[model samples]
Structures are given as C-alpha cells and as structure tokens.
Target: MTSAPPTETARNDDQAPPPEQPAGRRAAPSPVWPGLRALAGLLRPQRGRLLAGIALGLLGSLLGLAQPMAAKHVMDSVGQGQPAVGSVVLLSTLVLAGGLLAGLGHYVLDCSAESVVCTARRRLTHRLPRLRVPVIEHTEPGDLIARVTSDTALLRRTAPQAASAAVTGTLITVATVVMMGLLDAVLLCVTLTVVAFVGLVVILVTPHIGRATRHTQEAVGRMGAGLERTLGALRTVKAAGAEQRETAALHRAAEYARRAGVRAAAWEAVSTTLSAVVLQACFLAVLGVGGARVTSGSIGVSTLVAFLLYLFALAPRVGQLVEGVGQLQIGAAAAVRLREAEALEVEEAESTEPDRPEGDGDETAPAPEQAPGSHERHRHPAAVAFQQVHFTYRPGLPPVHRHVSFTVPAGGMTAIVGPSGAGKTTVFALIERFYEPDAGRVLLDGRDVRRWPLARLRAAIGYVEQDPTVLAGTLRDNLTLGAADATDEQIAQVLRLARLDTMTGRLPHGLDTQVGHRGSRLSGGERQRVAIARALLRRPRLLLLDEATSQLDAANEAALRETITDTARRTTVLVVAHRLSTVTTADRILVMEAGRVRARGTHAELMARDSLYAELASTQLIAFR
Candidate 1:
C-alpha cells in the first residue's frame, strides 16, 4: 500500500539534479555581457546614492592630486632658504582633508552596498515561495540558499570596489600622468614605459583570476549542498554508521573548493606582486633618468621631488584600477548566479482575477457550494474533483498520473489507498496546484482550479505533506504557523485534540519551548502531532493529510484517528495511508494502481467485489492489526 515518500531533499537530489549545476546545458552559465547587465540592474535602483559616493571619491582624488603640488611648494620654499611654514601647513591640511573625504566616500558606498544586498534578498524571498514545484524539485536547496546568502554578499563587497576603481582610481591615474608630463616630459616617458608593460602583464592575468573565482564559488555551493544533505539526514546517517563515508564525500567537495581558491589566489598574487614591483621600478627609473636631466639642467630639484611624489600617488590609483577590474569580474560571476535563481518561474499573482466586462459571467460562476445545513455536519467544507488529470515531475518522464479522476462531497472523510509509487500522494499535489496537469481539469467547489484565485483556493484547504516538516522555532510558533491570528484557546483546543497536551506538560517551557532544527529535538510522533495541530488550527474547509498517522504509535494513532473522524463531521478530510486499518472507517476509499484509479468502494464492498482489493486486504495489509 502507499507510504510516505522519502525526504524531499533526498528524492530531488537523487532523482533530478539541477540543470544549473552538473547536469549542464539547460541553464548554462551566461556569457560576460548578461552577467554585467544583471549587475547593472542590481545597482540601478541605488544610482542616486551610488553616484553621490562616486562624486565624493572624485573630489577626494582631486584633493589627493593637489597634495603633491603643495609638497613641491614646501620643497621650493625650503630650497630657497625661505620660511616654509605656510607651505608645510598647506600640505598638512590637504592630507587631513583628503583622508576625511575618502572616509566619507567609502561610508556612503558601503551603505549603498548594504541596501543593494537587502533588496536582492527580499526579491529572492518573495520569488522563492511562488516558484513552481518542479523547479525546486530539480534544484538543490543549499545552492539556492547560497545564491541568497553568499552571492548577494559578493555583490555587496565587490560592487563598491568596482565603482571606485572605474571612476576615482582611473581619474587619479590620468591626472597624475598629466602632472608628471608637466614636470619633465622626457623623464615621464621612462616611467610610462615601466607602468605600461606591467599594466599589460596584469591585464593578461586577470581573466584567469575571474574564471578561478567563478569556479571557486561554484565549488562552495556544491559543498554547501553536500553539507545540507548530510545535516538534513543526520539521524539516519548516525543510525546507519555512515558518518565516515559522508564525511569523506564532504571532504572531497571541500578539497575541490580549496583547489579552486588556490588557483584564484595564484592569479591574484601575480597581478598584485607585479603591480608593487612595477611601482618600485618606475621610481628607480625616474630617479635615474631625471638625475641626468638635473645634471643637464632639464628640470629643477623641486620638480624631481614632485614627480616622484606623483608616482607615489599613482601607486594606490593603479592598484585600485587593477583591483577594481578583478572585483567587477567576481561581482559579475555572482550576479550571474543570482540572476539564474531569480529567473526561476514564480507563480503569478493568482489572488486577483482579471477585470471583466460588466455583463461578463462570475469568475466562479455557479460555484459548487455545499447546501446550507444539508449534512449531519454543521460547518463549512470544500468539494474536490479530479478529471482525467495527467502529470509528470519533468518533461520526457513517464506521467505520474494517467487519466486519473475522482471526486469527494463536502463534509466527509475520503481516503486514497494503493501500493507505493502508485501516485496516491500526487493527488494531494495536484489538489494544491503545486504542479499543473498536462491535460484535463482539477476542480475545487465546481470551479476549475486554474480559474480560481490561487490564494482563495489555497486558503480554503490545509495540506500536510508526506514528511511532516517542523521548522526550528517555539512550540507555539509551529502550532500557529498556518493561523497567525489563532487565539490561545484555539491553540489549547487543538493541542488537546491532537493528544499533545501531555507533551506540553513535559516541556521545559511548555508552548514556548524551542523545537530544535526541523524539530530534531522532538520524537517523530511528536513532530507529526505538531504538524496535525498546526493544520487543524487553520480551520480549513478541506484538510488533506498524507501519511498523517504514520509516525504515531498505535495508541496515539487510534486517538488521532478518532479526532479525524470527528473533524470530518464538520469539514472535508482526505487521507493517503498505507495501513488499511486507518481508512476502513472512511466514507469513501479509492483504490489506485499504475497511475490510474482502478476501483472505488468501502472496505466491505471492495472485499466482496474486487480481487486486487481483496488480495491487498488479505495479504498486503494485516486486516486485524
């Protein structure tokens, strides 16, 4: 009979790796321009602040350019044996002012960087919830998380460096060169030759650095995925005694990241060391060539001192220019990854129906609402139907649901039972509209689900997945996740109904006690009950529970099962179960096989009429268990 599927991460990672990762081609890494465009788009919203920062940096660079002139004046005064106090004071003031401007400029840029990261993160969070289920199925959660965390961080840190390099650094380098030429054109030629050669060397080495950085980041993402996979199944790994094997695999991923980092560092080292060495060589060459000019009276001593000071100024500028290019490269790569993640298809705003003509029919025309007080129940309930629905997790794969069709009336318990991989759980997936059917319609309350406002459709139903998920939070937080405005009485009521009142008494902080990561601190049965209580609190018209009672002990399962039967008196309930004992009391039981609904009847009816159901009842499940 049907069982809950394995952990979602394991199923996704094992069966369908992401195209953006190792599978390759479907979402290949974008070329240079697209990444740059993505980076530009991220910065565009912050242009006002970013530009203000750049203006400050430019002003600072101009101030720094004037310092050499101020120093030259001081030198000239000293050489002439005149009072140099005024010149010295000018140089000191320029130094202090330049420092202040630079600090202010960097501060503005950092704030803009932080704002960009914040915006990118918000966009990711918004899109992620609405992404079509298949995209998430194919991709690694850890890698997606890396894009939100690591990639945005890269964008923030490198973006500021790029801005300063492109503007202030280049402008300073050019202005310094102009001043050097004014001092002595002949000596300027020697300095330019050394700088130009080293500049070409750095340029030649930079593309390699960029490629290495991209590889390193990709490796880091893979390592994160591996770690997440392990941590997510920590208990299973420990029970299986496979910790060494898992650790060794993670080590391999880490080693790959380390090697990629080493390659990036080597290229960076070459660029930086060459830049430093060339500056020293330029100083020596200018000293050698300009001394000859001094002997020949081509320039004054003050002019030589000033030219050398300009070269000193050029050192930081040239380094900035080189470093900026590298940061741009790194930022561009991170931007590409971020863009890929953001590009994943998001569910459109499904809460609003399109505007219609005054005479147009109602969107949920003749909505199939339950008759007022028509049943033994005395509350709201949803009607659900599937009509010839077909679906697959991915294209080119065999369909999970083939010509599947079923229906349930309002305010009763309905159960789907079948062997494993028989598409039982997929029924819940379709009802929730997590994945669209390749053919036919899924109707909720007599309206095609696609035609219903997505939010309205979902709000009417509560679904618990095959694997009960309990996020790290307080016990109360987990209980109230679906119903934020739930009153304390409502919480207390469900806690008692789900047999959790006893559990709370043992908790150190009762409802306020922290549920460890994924509720790791809770037993499997405790987590399942917490999930059930959360769903009940939503007060949904339709409640779908897949393997809802799988984790519970026989005693607790029997208790919860009675609660479910009572809940069906007032609301629609659908369950997927492997144990026949749980569903024998259901108002209707569906028998599914090989993606098709083979039969439908109560336990007694099926036992009398169908061999497959009889065989299943007799051998597949213990009838008296």
Candidate 2:
C-alpha cells in the first residue's frame, strides 16, 4: 500500500551561485552604447512618465533662467532710480516657481526609475527559481546577488537621472545661446563656439567614464565574492590558522575596487568641472564683447543681463550630463555582469508519455500520483541501470563520469563503495537527474529515466545525504521531513520503528520539541534516526541512504543497523556505505573503483574471492569492530 506524500515544500537552494570565474584571458570591455541601448528597453513601458519628467525638467530649467534675469532687473531698476515693487515681486515669484518645478521634476523622474526597477526585480526573482539545477550549480551566489540586488539598484538610480538631465541640459543650453544672440549676434557666436567645444569634450569623455564606472561595480562584486569565500570556510580557516591570509586576500580585492572607483570619480570630476570652467570662460567673452556693443549702441544693458542669466541657468543641466555620463557608465558595467548570470541554461521538464494499461492498450495512462516516494507510470521493478553514461561540467574539460555503465537489481540491498573522486556521489546525482548525462542513458526498469519528469523520478526514491540536513523545527517535524502530510499515527509508528520513540517520550514537548539549527540541539545519532524516520515515513519503494550512520556512535549505529535491516525487507535499499558494518550487512556489495564497479557479490563470497574485497574486509571490517 502507498503512504502519505511529504507535505513539506521541496527543500531547495534558494541562494544564487558565485560568479563564474572568467575563462582564459580577461575579455576586453565592450562599448557602453550597447549596454545603454539594452537599458533603453527597460524604459519603454514607462515612456509616458519619462516624457512628462523631461517636460517638467525643461520648464524648471527655463524658470531657473528667469532667476538670474530677475536679479539683474532688480539691480538695474535700483541703479536707474526707484525699483518697481510689482516688477520685483513678479521676478521673485518666477524664480520661486522655478525652484518648485525643479523639485517636482526630480520626483517624477525618480518615480519612473523605480517602476522600471520593480519590474526587473520581479522578472529576475521569478526566473531564478525556474533556472535549471546545473545552471545554478555552475554559478556563483555572490555575483548573482550583486546583479539582482546591487546592480539593479544602480540602474534604477542612474537611468531616470540621466534621461532627465539630458533633456534639461539640451533645452537650457539652447535657450541660453538664443538669449545671447539677442544681446549681440557676433558676441553670441563666440560664446556658442566655446560652448560647442565643451560639448565635444563631454561627448568624447562619456564612453570612457562609463567603462570605468562598470569596472568599479565589478570590482565591488569581486570583493563580495571574496567575503563569501572567507565566511563559507570560516571553520577551515580557523583550524588552519589562515586568518591573516584571508584578510590580505580581501584587502587585495578591496584595493581593486577602490582603484576602479577612484578612476571613475576622477573622470566624472574632470568632465563636469571642465564644462563649468568652459561656461565661465564663455560668459567672460560674452561680457567683454557685449560691453563693447553696448557702448557702440548695438546692444542694451538689459539684454546682456538677461543673456547672462540664461547662461547661469544652463549650468545645472550641463552639470547633469557629466554626472549622467558617470552613472550611465556604471549602469552599463553592472548590466554586463548581470547578463552573464542571465545567460545560464535553464533545463526544461521532460515529456512523460504515460504508460498504457494492459487491457486498454491506450497511450495515455495516467501519470503516477506524486507521493513521498512514488515512481512514474512506466517505472517497473527491474533495477537502476546506466548505459554508456557520459557527463561533463563544461565543454573541453575532462569528463567527470565517462562512459560509465552499471546496474543494481531490485529486491536486494546494493552497497556502492568507492574512494574519493571515483564519482560516487555523482552516481546519486545522476540518478536524481540534477544534471543530464551529456551522452548516454540512465534506465530504471528498462525504461530510459530521462523520459520521466524529474520531480516524479526523484519522488520514487528516498535520499538521505551524507551531512543529513535537518531544519530547525519540532522533533516531529524533522522526523516527517519528506512525509509532511503523514498522519500523526503514521508519524508515531515511524518514530517507533526508527527507535526514536523513546527519545520523543523523554522530550518535554514529546514530538513537538524544537530542534535547533541543523539539529545541533540533538546528538549525532538522534539526528541520523530523525533522517531515517523521515525516509521511512514515506514508505518509499526505493530507499537511498548515503552514509546515514557515519555520525552515530557504536550503540546508536547498532540500533540504526537494526532499523535499516527491518526497513529493507519492505523496500529496495541502495546505500553508499562509508562503514564496513553497512557493507557486510548489505545483501550484496558493489565495490566501485575509478567510476566503474569492479566486483559484486555477498560479503562472504566477495571476501573469499576478490583480493580487494578481502583486503577491505580485513582492514575496514576490523576497524568497524
């Protein structure tokens, strides 16, 4: 009879992987325009808001132009004789209104930017979960985090600011030049000529400024990666006494970030300050020639005053271009990094052409109802088989598992024992379909396993990892990890069978007692039993236990062995054994050496025949005793 399915959500690695180490020589940075063009797509949906922002910014820039003109009018009026109160009031009001408009304009632009960012974050967060396991396995967590969080934040801030500034700057500059021409056409010509030169300089410097900014963001991400590496290995570092070495490594990464940041800042400062300086120089020239024109009766003092006011109004807009250039560069750099992770290969769910019922002979047999452990419709009780399975992490790298072929039949417990790097864990990994074999097929009951949806296939087998991950929850909750939906009676029964029922009885809250992080609150043996109870709760047809008893003491180990011996009678058990006890107790042992099974037989038969088995039995079996 089938058992209750696990009610718990599939435990997942929600965190992103580290950034992929760049291959070979460092790639030369691409032109920023492409990144900017890519960013433009993000803005398309908010074009109406963007346009409104630009319009407001232009009005604000025009109002700002009136501020200096109003001050000049007040000065001229006072000098002439008596200043008109009405005129002064009107000019002051214009200046005040302009300031308000500028503030509102900024708000609108920022709002649009926020909208774009929200959309991008939503899209990326959703996509991350859907990504293939292999893609996530190959990626770096820190770099992906930087892209999703930090880089996107930068884009939101920069895009709107740049767009608004570009619009306002263009309008103000043009308005100022026109006002100057009204004062004295020849003088305006000289002023605008210098302004043109400044514009040219800004354009020439913009691309480089963006490149430098992008490099700065990347350097920062690398610093984060370094921090992650250090933290992940904190225990190892402490054991090895390598704190100083890690500190130095982090410092180097920080230095690179600092250098990149400084370079970006320097370029921004130079470009902006130059624009201001050139504008000032142009103002001086306009003044010198306008003074000559006024004396010659070719221009009025009021006209020259208004022209200078317009020029000063143009400064904020011009300054924005410089800052915009810097931010745009930063955004581009972030995009490149983000794009790297975005390009990961997401695996699709395999097609399941349900098995035909014997009498009906129809092609569409219902897919198996998913339970804690349930096989697909086509699944039969043959065995696990790898037919010429070839696998690799990346192209051109040596294959991790090459042309590996093996079989473990149903109804008997098979122990696969091998040395480190013999691709032992990889066998479990392939069976679970964490990755597809590059070439070849994995068969279960003579049917290619790849034909089954990964979820259904994994549900068919109970897996207990070496580390035996246990969440922080009640003891009962942990025991029912895979069988969340299991009834209390079923839970109580499993607890009794795994020999954890006595522990549960002693607990202050019975089964409800909280288990701390990774079940640290429990003893090693208790944790192992909890995992076993969890697997057993599913009444799995096929049980996969990976070094389940490695953490237990002798007494607990014996108890666990007894439990496993009982459970195996009702299920097909395959174990990756680290202990000789497990190997000896296993009905049959498959001794693996260098990614291939070298020998397979009962413990006594193998020990009596195979030299390697005999040697292992002598050394490790004695150690087990």
* The candidate that achieves the highest lDDT relative to the unseen native structure: 1
TM-score of 2: 0.81
Query: What is the Cα-based lDDT of residue 529 in candidate 2?
Result: 78
Pairs in steric clash, model 1: none
Tens-place lDDT per residue, model 1, 1-625, is 3432233542311222224332211344456667778888999999988888988888888888999899899888888899999988888888888888888988999999999999999999999878876666667777778888988998999986597677787788888899999888887898789879877976788777777777777877888888988998898999999999999999999999899999988998888888888888888888898888888988888898899889888888898888887788788888888888888887765532344454532343333343221232125787788888987666666667888988898889998877666778778877887778898777776667776667666767778765788999999999988678889999999999999999999999999999999998999899999999998888788899987888889999999999999999888999987677776889998988778899998999988887777877776454311
**lDDT, candidates in the order shown:** 0.80, 0.70
By summed lDDT, the worst window of 10 consecutive residues in model 1 runs over 9-18
Clashes of each: 0, 9
TM-score each candidate. 0.92, 0.81
List model 2 lDDT by residue over 385-432, tens digit each. 788887765565556566888777765688776554455656777777
What's the true lDDT of residue 75 in model 2? 73
Clashes by residue pair, model 2: 7-484, 7-485, 16-141, 17-140, 17-141, 18-140, 18-141, 19-140, 210-329
